[model samples]
Target: MSGPGSAVLAQLLAQSAGQGADLLALRAIAEEAGDLAAGRALARLGLEDAQAAKDMAELRELLAAWRAAKKSLWKAVLGWIVKMALVLMLAGLAVKLRLWELLE
Candidate 1:
């Protein structure tokens, strides 16, 4: 429809899969129909669909790296805690056995 009063854009989208609908053609139709709002909507919808179809592998990889970093950080903290505990236990044993006096 080439008139504002003609076919509504929302109705068209609801009725069809928008497979054959071209953004440029839709804009032209909306312009000729004096409906800039519909033209903008059509362009926005087309761009959104285009972006959604793009590959997201980089996003997935970044998420994986973040998860790995979080895991590694926790492991390092736990490792440090274990090492400190062992050192403290060894010192306690030396004090209980009076090993420092023997060193003198």
Candidate 2:
């Protein structure tokens, strides 16, 4: 009943029961309730500090760097696999064509 929203709700109920309701008072109470709810939500998300935005940006940058490193590593591995396949194919062609005897 002490909370702003509850107080406003109680006032509404009182008005319904024939008491005169003040529009500004009800509006102020509702605004206070909305502000309190927003504050609580920010606190719950751990973003109530001045440094929270900076911390979030750093985390995003770290994630992007990690993803780039993983992509580069995969590309390098694929390049090596392709090179090995080419070497093997050339070796098999040389053996079939008796090209080694030509070098003697």
Error of 1 at 65 (Å): 0.3
Candidate 2 lDDT over 1-104, as tens digits, reads 68896777777756754655666676677679879998899999998899988999999999999999999999999999999999999999999999999999
In model 1, which regions exceed 4 Å deviation?
1-55
For model 1, the run of ten residues with the poorest summed lDDT: 47-56
- The segments of candidate 2 whose C-alpha lies over 4 angstroms from its true place after superposition are 1-38
- Residues 43-74 of candidate 1: C-alpha lDDT, one tens digit per residue: 78663344543535666788999999999999
Q: Which candidate has the top score in lDDT? A: 2
| Model 2 vs. true fold: TM | 0.60
Best by TM-score: 2
* Candidate lDDT (C-alpha), each: 0.73, 0.87
